[model samples]
Target: MIKKVILLGMAVFMTGSIAMAQHGGPRGNKRGMAKDLTPAQLATLQTKKMTLALDLTAEQQSEVLRINTEDIEARQAEHEELKQMRLENDQSTNRAEAQFARQKARLDSKIARQEKLKEVLNAQQYAQWKKMNRHLERNRRQPPQ
Candidate 1:
C-alpha cells in the first residue's frame, strides 16, 4: 500500500511538471521582457528621430505626426479585426492561410508608409536617414556583449 501511494505521488508530480513546462515553465523570467511603450513615448521617439534625421520644421513635424497617428490607428484596427476573426474560428489550415495573408498585408502597408515618409524628406535628409538606418541595422545584427 505504501509503495502504491509513493508511485501515485511521483506520477502526479511528473505530470504537473510536464504541464508547466509546456506553458512556459516557472523558470521563465517574464519581468525581463520588453514592455510596450505608451503612445506619448512612441510619439516622442518618432519626433526626435524625424527632427534629427530630416531637420523637420514645426510644420513638417506636425504633418509627420499626423501621418504617423493615422498609420497607427489603421494598424490597430486591422489587428483588432484579425483578432476577432481568429477568435471566431478554431485553428485550421484556412485560418492559418488567412493569418499569413493578413500579416503580409500589414508588412506591405508599413513599407508603403515608410516610402511615403521618404517622399516628405529632402534629398540630403533622405540620404542621411538611409545611412543612419543602415548603421542601425548593422549594429542590431551584432551579438550583444
Candidate 2:
C-alpha cells in the first residue's frame, strides 16, 4: 500500500511538471508592443500619458503627439528590421558581432529624442522627462521578483 501511494505521488508530480513546462514562461508568452497595438493608437496613448506626466500645454501636447507618432513609426520600422535580421539568421555567435557598435544606433536614436525634447519642453518639464526616462530604464533592466 505504501509503495502504491509513493508511485501515485511521483506520477502526480511528473504530470504537474510536464503541464508547467508545456505552458511556457512569461517571456515566451509575451507579445511585442508593436505587434499588440497599432502605431497610431500607441502614439496617442504615449502622448496622453506624457501630457498627464508633464502637464503639457495644448501646443506642447500637439508637438509631443507629432514626436510620439514619428517615434512609434521609427520603432515599428526597427522592430521589422530586427525580425528580418532574425529571419535571415544574420546574428552570428561571435564576440566581434556581439560587442561594440551594437547599441550605437539605438543610443543615437535616444540622443536625438533628448535633443528634440529639449527643444520642445521648458527646463522643468525636460528635467522631469529625463528623470522619468531614467526611472523607466532602471525598471526595465531589473529582474522581476
Candidate 3:
C-alpha cells in the first residue's frame, strides 16, 4: 500500500510539472509580450531603459521620453490601420502593395527615430546606442536554446 501511494504521488507530481511547463508561465505562452500593452506603457518602459543605459540628463531624458511616446503612438496607429484594412477585405489593395507600403513606413519611422535620437544624444552616445541596437538585433535573430 505504501509503495502504491508513493508511485501515485510521483505520477501526480510529474503530470503537474508537465502541465505547467506547457502552460508557459502565468501568461499562457503568448509570443509577443508587448502585444497586449498600451503604447504609453511601452514608451515609458523604453524611455526608462534608454535613460538608464545612456546616462541621460533631465532634459535629454524628457526629450527621449517624448520621442518614444510619439513613436509608440505612431506605430500603434499604423498597426490599427493595417488591421482595419485587413478586416475590410479591400481587394483594391494588393498583397505586394500593402507589404511595400508597410516596409516603407517602417523604414521611414526608423530613419526619423534615428535622426531624432542623433539630435538628442551626443556623438558618442549615439554610437553606443547604435551598437546596443545591433547587439539586440543579433540576439533576436538567434534561436533560443
Could you say which candidate leads in lDDT? 3
Q: Estimate the lDDT of model 3.
A: 0.89
Q: Name the better of 2 and 3 by TM-score.
A: 3
Task: Give lDDT tens digits, candidate 1, residues 42-125.
Answer: 666666787977788787787677767667667767867877776876566586688799889888987877787787777787
Alpha carbon deviation, residue 68, candidate 1 (Å): 1.2
User: Model 1 compared with the native: what TM-score?
Assistant: 0.55
Among residues 3 or more apart in sequence or in different chains, the pairs in candidate 2 whose N, CA or C atoms overlap within 3 Å are: none
Which candidate, 2 or 3, has the higher lDDT? 3
Order candidates by TM-score, high to low.
Answer: 3, 2, 1
- Candidate 1 displacement at residue 10 in angstroms: 32
Model 3, 1-84: lDDT tens digits are: 999999999999999888877887456655477897888888888989988999888999889988999999998899898899
User: Runs in model 1 with CA error above 4 Å?
Assistant: 1-41, 89-93, 134-145
Each model's RMSD to truth, in Å? 9.0, 4.7, 2.8
RMSD of model 3, in Å?
2.8
Please report, as a residue range, the 10-residue window in candidate 1 with the lowest summed lDDT: 29-38
Worst 10 residues of 3 by lDDT: 24-33
In candidate 2, how many Å is residue 77 off? 1.0
